[model samples]
Target: MSTITYYLDMQRPEQIIGKPLPADLSVVECQHKQYQLNRFLYQLVGEPWQWTDKLSWSDAQWRALIEQPGHRTWVAYYQGAVAGYYELLRDAEGVVEILYFGLAEAFFGQGFGGPLLTQALQSAWAWPGTTRVWVHTCSLDHPSALANYQARGLRIYREEVEAEAP
Candidate 1:
């Protein structure tokens, strides 16, 4: 098997198509750098998609990433329940990357992906000195993941395919 990774980017905030969040769904930035919370969210929303890069990370490793000055997390709540989340990281070059994004297993197919992604893009652009916003998604992700990113005005800048060992 092979995994295909697509790199996408938006040169300007105006490029975003922007979707309005549903009344019952709201997203808010996590004001605290709680590694445990981020770890929980990673496992919760990434389970079905096979996200395992951080599965073996130690507490210190998680803390280091979460505590980075340019790292930020935002969670989406649906009717007061944790529905989804996204993480943004800005480099010194003024580029913001949507490092992680997804809906919880219980929230899939509920029309929340687009709006949540819109929030991600908007929030990325809101960062001071943001010159570009970007993200990457692979074939192992949700089928609509790439579509949703494109619908939000992110254009494909690169792609890669890697063979998976059995």
Candidate 2:
């Protein structure tokens, strides 16, 4: 199989289109490092999309990745239930990368992706010294993934196709 990966970036905060969260939905940062919760979320939101890179991550690996100084996670709650999540990491040069972003299987098609992504971008830009915010999505992701990113003002910076084992 061939997987197409698109790299997107926002050079300024004003670039974001800004979608407001619905009255019944809210996004909050996971202030404390919790590898277990992060692992669960990674599995929960990424299973259908073939997100296997972190599936084999040991507890210490997960902790080291998430417990770093510039890493952050945000979760979206729909009426108090876990709806979706995104993770952001800022590099030394002030670039914040949205490492992972997705909604749960149950939350699809309910108009959550846009607003959730907006919040993610806002959070990314809000980080101190942020010069750029970026993310990558592949063809394996939800069909709306690329559209949502573009609609939110992230411009394509690069694209590549890779062979994947079936």
Candidate 3:
């Protein structure tokens, strides 16, 4: 199988500003919980990336990744259950990357994605000296992924097609 991936970027501070969080939604910073992080990723990304192979990372690797400096993960709660989450990484050069962002399959289309993304962008922009914020999405991602980014003012800067092993 093959997929087309779009690389989107936002360099100006204006682009990173996002709407306020909805009344019932709240975001909590996840801390030192590799198992919970991995489980959340699997639940949110497993369906969209089904054509690709499953993720296989040891617990230690997961811990290392999550514990790295400048790496931040936020989980969204809707009246108490896990609804969605996003991870942000800020490099020394002041570039903030939205490494992963998604709503759980069960929470899709219930007005969660936008607010989640808004909070993610807001968090990214809050970092001192942050000059760029970016993320990548593929054809294999949710159908609304591309549109949502565009709607939030991220511009498509590059795109490419690649084959995926079955």
Best by TM-score: 1
Off by over 4 Å in 3: 31-36, 51-54, 163-166
Residue ranges of candidate 1 with Cα displaced over 4 Å: none
Ranking by lDDT: 1, 2, 3
TM-score for model 3? 0.87
Alpha-carbon TM-score of each model against the true structure: 0.97, 0.97, 0.87
**lDDT of candidates 1 onward, in order:** 0.96, 0.95, 0.81
Query: Which of 1 and 3 is the better model by lDDT?
Result: 1
Best by lDDT: 1
Cα misplacement distance, residue 58 of candidate 2 (Å):
0.7
- Residue 165, candidate 1: how far off, in angstroms? 3.5
Clash pairs, model 1 backbone: none
Report model 2's TM-score to 2 decimal places.
Answer: 0.97
Candidate 3 C-alpha lDDT tens digits along 1-32: 78899999998868754666789999988766
Model 2 C-alpha RMSD vs. true structure (Å) is: 1.2
* Candidate 2 lDDT by residue in tens digits, 6-65: 999999999999889999998889998898999999999999998899899899999999
